[model samples]
Target: MAWLSPAFPVGGFSYSAGMESAVVEGHVGDGDGVEAWLGVLLAHGGLRNDAILLAEAHRVQGEGQSLEEIISLATALASSAERHAETTRLGEAFVKAAAAWPHPVIDVLVGPVPYGVAVGAVAAAHGVDRVDAIAAFLHAQISQYVSVAIRLGVIGQTRGVSILAASEAPILDAASSYARLDLDDLGSATIIADTLSMRHEIQYSRLFQS
Candidate 1:
């Protein structure tokens, strides 16, 4: 459960998924805009990609294979400095956290793996079944994104929780369906997210690393 804690210190608060840039461009100027953006991210972009990656990672770890190749792939396909930085930084942090409270499954995952992969590994270590692990992983992301949304001052705390509550079924459904996916079926192409992350590079008034 430590991994699910918002206080786990993964630097999650630092990124706003280009919300700053969007707001500055007047694309997300109010609470409705923020809610809509959060909804899109939860349904089609952020959570979807992460859920697929983590579920695949869980299935792989559960089968007792090394995650070296997948970890490298996740990082390489990260697409932007902020994206890369977010995954690797959290990967390293997960490693350190795992070391302090060693679990055999997670101990085998001791290196830079993507956040999704590492969480899946740890969930396996803690004896969570595959589907539940993926659900938990997505749940954590929903909470984190909402937390960041709060920091963005785009919505109040109640609104953030409401957004998360509204998203629970979709995220779990995604996890259930996605957890069954094999690597061959594993892919994400959320172009707007990638573009926003790329545009984040040039945004002078940015509130996020990406």
Candidate 2:
């Protein structure tokens, strides 16, 4: 929780994962919309893929394998320029802050690591349960998007909390399934989310980075 929390210094509050764009374009307008949009992501989009990467990273780090391949693949999987920046920037911050735990995996993570890879690798090195790490990571992501929705005037605090409460099943399911799946299963089908993220890159006025 501390690692992926809003106060953890990943600058997560500044990125919406394209939620800002979704709101601006009317793709998401209220609590229901937020829930539905996030549901798609958790099941078939970036969040799903992130879960897979996190699981793989956890496995490799636990086995003391080099993370070069996973790192490269994570970067290459970004759906857009802003998406790329979001993951790498957050990953860098996560690694920097996670160094407080004093794990050798931190030093091994060179260059721009994706957020999932950093979290999974660090957590694995510290002996955090694989399932717990992925589930927490997914929850943090959903919470961030919920925050974005509230800030964008799409939902109030009460509604946002409800949305989070409602997302428990999807988060758990994704985490469970992805933890068992390998790299070959890493894929996203959330076209609208991906396109919104790309459109957010060039959006003339925007509150979030992506």
Candidate 3:
């Protein structure tokens, strides 16, 4: 829980996952819209991809598999430049912070890494269960976007909680399925979310990074 907390210093708050542009473009105008949009993202897009990566990373670490190859593929799978930057930047920060606390696996990881890979590495190093780690990672991602929704005024505090509550079943189902899959299963179909992320890169005036 500590690693996934908003105060963990991963700079998650700075990235909106394209929600800012979605709000600006009027795709997500209210709490209900925010819920619907998030549902798709959680089910088919970046969140799904992240979950698969996290699960694979955890599995590899536990099985004594190669971290380098996993990191390489995870980096290449990023759907957009901003998405790549967001994961790599947060991953670098996560690795540095994990190093400070001292973990054997952390010392082995060198160079750039993806956020999901970093999370799996650290969790495995700490002997955390794969299911628990995946759940935390998904929760953190969901919370970050929900926080963005609140900041964008698309959802009130109460509404944000409601949306989260509504997401519990889907999050569990996705996490469970992803945990059982291999890295080759990684894929995303959130076109609008990806478009929003791309559009955010050149958005004239933006409140978030990506």
Candidate 4:
């Protein structure tokens, strides 16, 4: 839980995952919109993609698969430059902090890595259960976006909590579904979210990175 905590220093608070653009476009104007946007993300967008990567990384590490291969695939999966930056920056930070704790598996990762790969590797090295790791990762992603909405004044504190609460079932479902998916099964249908993320790159007066 410490790894996924808001206070973990992953610099996650700086990225809005395209919610800022969505807000500017008026696609997400309130708590309900925030919840709906997150629902789509958790169900079919970056969150789903990350969940699959996390699960596959966890499984591959246990099966003696090459970490380099996983990292390469993950890096390729990033849909945009900002998305790539987000994962790599967060992944690098996570690996640095996790290395201080000295995990034999994670220590072998020499250079930058993707966030999902780093998470799965560290979780496996630390003996965290696959299910728990995926769930926590999804929850952290959801919480980050919700926090973004709150910061944008799209949702109040109580309503943010409520939105998160309402996401519990969907998060579990996505985790469960993604856990059974293989690397080849990876795909995303969140065109709007992806477009917004791309558009965020040139957004003026932006408060978040992406």
Candidate 5:
């Protein structure tokens, strides 16, 4: 819980994972819209792929295996440059803060670990249950997207929390299923989100990183 919390210093608050662009484009303009956007991410987007990566990282660490390939794949799977920067920067920060748990896996993270891999590997080293960790990670991700909506004036705080409340089922569904997935299952279909992230790179009046 602490690892994925808002105050964990991962800077997750500063990046919207392309939701900022979605909001500006009027694709997500209200509470229900935010919820639907999140549903897409949970079911078929970067979030789903991240869960697969996290689960793979958890299994790799639990089995005392190298994370080199996971790290590379996670980086490669990023749909845009800003997306790549967001995951890697947040991952490096997560590894730095997660050092409080004192694990050898933390030491092996030489550079630019993807956020999911960092969280999953460190959680495995600390004996966190795989499904629970993935659930928390997914919850954190969705919460960040909701926060982005709130900050963008698309939804009020009460509506933000309401969306979060409505999101629990999808979060659990993705987490439970994704915890068993392998890298072969890693793929995303959120083309608009990915395209918006690239568009965000050139958006003149951006409020978030990506």
Candidate 6:
């Protein structure tokens, strides 16, 4: 639940991961667009690609699997310089909060533990099973996307929440399937979002950090 709360001090509020660009282009500035974008994320790239990795990381932590491999795979899969900084930033935050739990693996993978791996580790420490842990991670992800979109003025609270509400089943379905996929299958194709992130780099004026 800590990971899902928007109030968590992970600096997640500052980054949009390119939603600003999409908004500027009028492509994602409304409910329909938000639905479409989130649908695409759930149906294709973001959900399966990234959420699966999160699930795997959780399972690894649960089953006494290899931390090295999990971290390596997660790092490789967690692309985007800004997004990487974003995830690592949150991971670092969680590290501080999770100190009392004292997982050696968490200590070792402290700095850039790949968002998924870190989330999984934290979930395990908190005694959440891998599946539920993945659900929380995926829920947080979709919520963040919606939150960023709202910050971009692409949607209002009702629409933003509707977008999240609409995405729940797909996110859960995809996450469940993804949890069973291999790291070799991990990859994202969020072209517009990724490009928007690049565009956010040069956007003359913007409200988001990307």
Q: Candidate 6 on 16-116: residue-level lDDT in tens?
A: 66677888877776789878877776666555666767777777777777777877766665556666666677777766666756667666665677666
Q: Which runs in model 4 stand beyond 4 Å of their true positions?
A: none
Q: Rank candidates by lDDT, best first.
A: 2, 5, 4, 3, 1, 6
Model 4: how far is 185 from its true place, Å?
1.5
Candidate 1 minimal-lDDT segment of 10 residues: 182-191
Query: Lowest lDDT 10-mer window, candidate 4?
Result: 103-112
Pairs in steric clash, model 2: 18-210
TM-score of 1: 0.88
C-alpha TM-scores of all predictions: 0.88, 0.98, 0.96, 0.97, 0.98, 0.88
- C-alpha root-mean-square deviation, candidate 2: 0.8
Better of 2 and 3 by lDDT: 2
1-210: candidate 2 lDDT, tens digit per residue: 899878898899999988888999998988899999999999899999998999999999999899999999999999999999999999999999998888778889877999999999999999999999999999999999999999999999999999999999888887788899999887778998999899998899988888
The better-scoring model by lDDT among 4 and 6 is 4
- In candidate 1 the C-alpha lDDT for residue 158 amounts to 90
Q: What is the lDDT of residue 53 in candidate 4?
A: 91
lDDT (CA) per prediction: 0.72, 0.92, 0.87, 0.88, 0.92, 0.72
Instruction: State in Å the error of residue 124, model 3.
Output: 1.2
Candidate 6 ranges beyond 4 A from true positions: none
The TM-score obtained by model 3 is 0.96
Cα lDDT tens digits for candidate 5, 1-210: 999989899999899999999988888888888899999989999999999999999999999999999999998888899999999999999999988888888789879999999999998999999999999999999999888888899989999899889889888887899998998887888899999999999998988988
Decoy 4 TM-score against native: 0.97
